[model samples]
Target: MSRILAILQKEFLQMKRDRLTLGMVFMLPLVQLLLFGYAIQTEVKHISTVVFDQSMSIESRDLLDSFSSSGYFDITGTAKGYAEITKMIDSGKAKAGIIFPPDFAEKLRKGETAPVQVLVDASDSMVSNSAIAVANSIGLLKSQKIIMQKTGVQSLPYDIRVRPWYNPDGITAYYMVPAILGIIVTMTMVMMTSMGIVREREKGTLEQLMVTPVKSYELMIGKVIPYIALGYLQITVALLVGGVVFGVPIRGSILQLYLLTLFFITASLGIGIFISNIARNQMQAFQMSFFVFLPSIMLSGFMFPREAMPSIIQYIGNIFPLTFYLTIIRGIVLKGIGFPYLIPQVMSLLVFSVIMMTLSIIKFKKKIA
Candidate 1:
């Protein structure tokens, strides 16, 4: 009993000296509770939308108003044509596009059913599904209203036509592939760099390297380049597996995917290097990497819906590199979108890479003492 008590005291003393580790130990649980509690929601809302109202009639305008007022969609822009609608969706400018055909009101007024094409960017299945549901409900309610006014009947008279674009069937693979790519990069980049640094420390090579004439920035570059190559290799393997094993189509340019992935790899490697600087041993490095991994998987819209999360948790997720990377990957893979549409995600990734790499370099110390 006395021996155990002495061991516990020694451990506590060690922890007291390592304030970062101690702080992480105490703060992680509380952070997880708050984050998961608010960020793990399944319900999606406030989807951004665009309207291409070719009809320009009272009926078509009323229908558009119905959608905007429903609280599910925020009408952000007005598209001029079908091409513009497609452009908006591809560029991540809008989640859904509501198009009213030229004769929509005429057909409806003539007692003939008119089709309103709802083009949904179904890469994010949760948001797409929610938007489709809301659109259908609005159509049905409007039809019922027309019926009640014309025929004194409360039944629905017209069909609320729905056409989900991009992913017509809403396959889970279509939605998950891009997100899984983000997770893979995060796990491999962080774990490999952390473990590699810790191994160097364990073998006493880190001290030897420090004594060499290599500049700090040069050494950092050398360490990161190899990991960046490894990241590309992992992406290649994962892409192949997704295509062959899961039948997930690569609709966009492979070169674009690789370039975008390069940005993400660097960002992830930056995080790993930062963790390596903080952790003293391999076990500690592994623990710290896991701490980062769990939140990333949960909060970056990888497994859960970001819309369901409280506003604060959603904002917290924006800090992660994966959150932006997922958007780029999904846009390319599922929507066949190019740089014009992917600028925002690319910019976000660039900013993240710059910040993380700068922080890691700044935090890196040249001497063991």
Candidate 2:
């Protein structure tokens, strides 16, 4: 225990002296959390829309007003023909185009189904999907009103009341901020730990410890303890910023969140130590860390939904500890669920921690060979 504490004390002193590393350790996560929390938005709004209304009647204008009033579509300009609409969409001037038929007014007056064509640029899926959904909703609402006026029915027979849970208003921060916390911890644990250890080998400092009587497990513990504290500090700052700046709610038990986060942190650090063990230089360590980090961003449901991915991709996503931690953090922070409901995610992180730590201990050679 004393030897481990000695190693721990040495690490803290070395870190303190390296002012640049200290700055990065604090500032990197803080800056990234603020930037990503503010920058990443899922709900697309104010789509640039072009309309080609051939009818030019009160009926068509009324329908167009509905689309404009919804706050999703902005009628930036009117197009004379389909060619102009297509050109506007292709040149990135407009994301959507609404076209009314020549007989749009006549069909409405004859009590027939008046079809309005909505053209959405499918280049960006997020923008296109929102445009399509909003257009459809506007059409349906208009149709429902017309039918009610004719038939005098109070409500429709089959009305599905949708209740969105967790994030009712679809606030992107509520979804993204908690996941960014996991990303921050993973970045420090995987990249910094591996690079720091590999740098020690480069500078011949790791070999100095070979003459000591310290066990491999003790050294690993020493290396991990300081980083664990740093990770928690990062989390604390992120939580404060997330709540204060973005209005993110911590609905579940704070103690449980802290307790379960240990498994995730250990799992990430084990991966870092294992990477350092395999990498011959800091460059190789960084490359390996990026290999882990990129997937944690893409495949781990950080930027995209895991359920939408193919089964094989989702299976591959499980390899990273971030995948499980995302669920845990999101559950605690947003869904307000406790340990009883988060058993699967917690157990996955626990098993991952055990496996990764065992591998790291086995792979960590005391001698610089």
Which has the greatest TM-score?
2
**Tens-digit lDDT track for model 1 on 1-369?**
443344345444654686875454334333433343345445577788999999899998888888889988888999999899999899998999988889999999898999999989899988988888988999887887787898887555566889987878766666765566677678768876776677678789778866876565555555555556555665676677567655778889999999888888878887898888888899888999998898888898888779999999999998888888888898899989978898887888788878877776666644333
Worst ten-residue run, lDDT, model 2? 360-369
Name model 2 segments beyond 4 Å from true.
365-369
Error of 1 at 51 (Å): 46
lDDT of 2 by residue, 61-107 (tens): 99989999999999999999999999999999999999999999999
Query: What clash pairs does model 1 have?
Result: 91-341
- Superposed by TM-score, candidate 2 places the C-alpha of residue 268 at a distance from the truth, in angstroms, of 0.6
Q: How far is candidate 1 from the true structure (C-alpha RMSD, Å)?
A: 16.2
RMSD of 2: 1.8
Residue 311 displacement (Å), model 1 = 1.4
